[model samples]
Target: MQALRIGTWNLASGRDGSGRSADAATLRAAVAGVDVDVLAVQEVDVGQPRSHGADQPAEVAAGLGARDWRFAAAVAGTPDPFRSWTPIEPPVLRGPDQAPSGPHYGIALLSRLPVRRWSVLPLGAGRAKLPLQAPDPRTGRNRWWWFPDEPRLAIAAELGHCTVVATHLSFAPHTALRQLVRLRRWCARLPGPVVLAGDLNLVGPVPARVFGAARLVSAPSYPATAPRVQLDHVLGPAGLDPQRPGAHRLALGDHRLVTVTVHPR
Candidate 1:
């Protein structure tokens, strides 16, 4: 089979710090520049007031002319709908298939390649009060906000040649690791080589160690303007050949778009 370009990005509600949403034209241009075959996106808002109720998955697929896409909600309601929040949901383990119905915060996948089937898994429902830092809208003060619930999810799609899993783990290092362990076990059940992509939350050698896969791409992706740490990644099962220097960073959204090419067996 031919090689394919796959990418992962956390679109901050399809906007920048200026609180302006990019027009469809600009979004299309950005995706065109990346030239990816499959794209995994996180922090997508569905029917939320912030994103103008944009169906982010469908919008991006239309922009890229992708053949298929899927979206799964992690949280139901946005605490601060008008304002942006990092680690949007509270750190709680909700049912994998149970996201509060209606408008919510979530993740999605877009694939230009043909997808045979797909599935979703909700991991790490354990609740913890995490110290979330965000600017207060009224006071404009950067303060520590303790959020009570946070949830993580993993979505997998089986394309003709490979199975790609998209997920966003918790910001807490230990929690993220625990979810990764569950994800690994889940991926093992699928056929063919599995391509894992998304924001792992925990950076450095920890992801590589826990996943037991080759890190195909490694670059600063978070805080796009002045990225210092690598938070996004494209990982694949052992023996799958990843092209060196094929990984690239695209300037789009708050998190830089990271992509990699793998020769399909």
Candidate 2:
């Protein structure tokens, strides 16, 4: 391939900036606007009534024209204000006959390019629910809570020459650091240079160091209305062609989208 385009976004389960529900059309359009070959998405809803029972991963993949994609359910139930999520024993089913069908919520990775193979790495849920800084609906004011240290996972799509990994780490600082460390070690066993895309929950420098990557995309994606921190990232290995990053605010969601393109090694 001459160039590789990658992106990452947290869909906020199809919620608009004001925390209003976004229809499937809005969700698809927001993702399509990025125009990336590979995308890693977080806060996805599958077979959930809150998202109008739509499969978020499938919708975005269709919008992006991605031929290969997978959604790993970190939690297998409707986790809402009235309830909490429980972790799946093994997010990836053991065999072809047993894929997860839900009322579940988790992360997803989609690719327009042909994938040689796909894999998932589970990052277990953090033990405690911690205070997090985020947006307050359309007001864009800072809110310090309303989040859980949810179960996490990394999904990789090997596109022959390079592998693109998608993940959302825990909000707890130490747990997120440990998860990033594990993910970096896991990538070491993959075939070639790897590009990781996701909302790592850690600030820029920490994830870069842990993943052994050069932070290419530097968009401050949190609090999409007026972002102050770059929680979303696109990190690539050495020998990558240099280029500026792209950040886009979507129709809805608490975070912005981050994209970057690089010449193939």
Candidate 3:
């Protein structure tokens, strides 16, 4: 059995807790310094103003000196200032140094191991209400609120040793449950030993039951200031002993990177 370190995080387009935008160097360090063999990233940007219109996934791969990476765009424009929109297309790998043709938002996976095949499966296309704590338009007071939902996606890459899947499920509770069911079925068809990682936007226990996979990490990963829930995760097929599963706190986003060490089945 070969051991591997897998990690997941919602990058929030590389914005730190203070709302400071990350540059190429900062982004690079975020990936390289994390010390994980494979990483699943969510809420990434491509040619979007919030993220300085950068091709984030590609940059991250370059930062890690990785040749294998895949990105799936779930929407066409930035979601900041939340408004309804549609995804331009499914996520695809950007060629080295290739510029984004338009602003896009999505999820990605970066790996030091070479990927043998790739596929992307999109979930619900309809809008769903997502609760948030934001400034109310009328009084500018910070309050609990709701916003237009974004498309969800699952991108999978078959590596030489294992297949890895990454995704960001819906924030809405009911919607998230449905997505989990779909995710389980989708993963079932992929080659094993499979590792699924990402900002699931749900509690740790929920997915564990559905996937029949061991939940390797359980630390709070969201609201970086005082995280109370484990929104990020790294899961492996059942009966696999995952060692040293934990979360790595960073000043880069509203999430603590979730990680685990597992031997491919």
Off by over 4 Å in 1: 17-19, 23-26, 81-101, 130-144, 244-252
Better of 1 and 3 by lDDT: 3
TM-score of 2: 0.89
Which pairs of residues collide in model 3?
72-91, 73-91
Backbone clashes for every candidate come to 6, 0, 2
Per-residue error for 30 in candidate 3, Å, reads 2.4
Q: TM-score for every candidate vs. truth?
A: 0.83, 0.89, 0.90
Candidate 1's clash total is 6
- Kindly list the per-residue Cα lDDT of model 1 for residues 64-141, writing each as its tens digit: 888878887776676552433344333332222433355777788888888898788878544556676666867867
Model 1 TM-score? 0.83
List pairs with backbone clashes in candidate 2.
none
Which prediction has the highest TM-score against the true structure?
Answer: 3
Q: Against the unseen true structure, what C-alpha lDDT does each candidate score?
A: 0.75, 0.81, 0.79
Stretches of candidate 2 off by over 4 Å are 81-84, 93-100, 131-147
Q: State which candidate has the highest lDDT.
A: 2
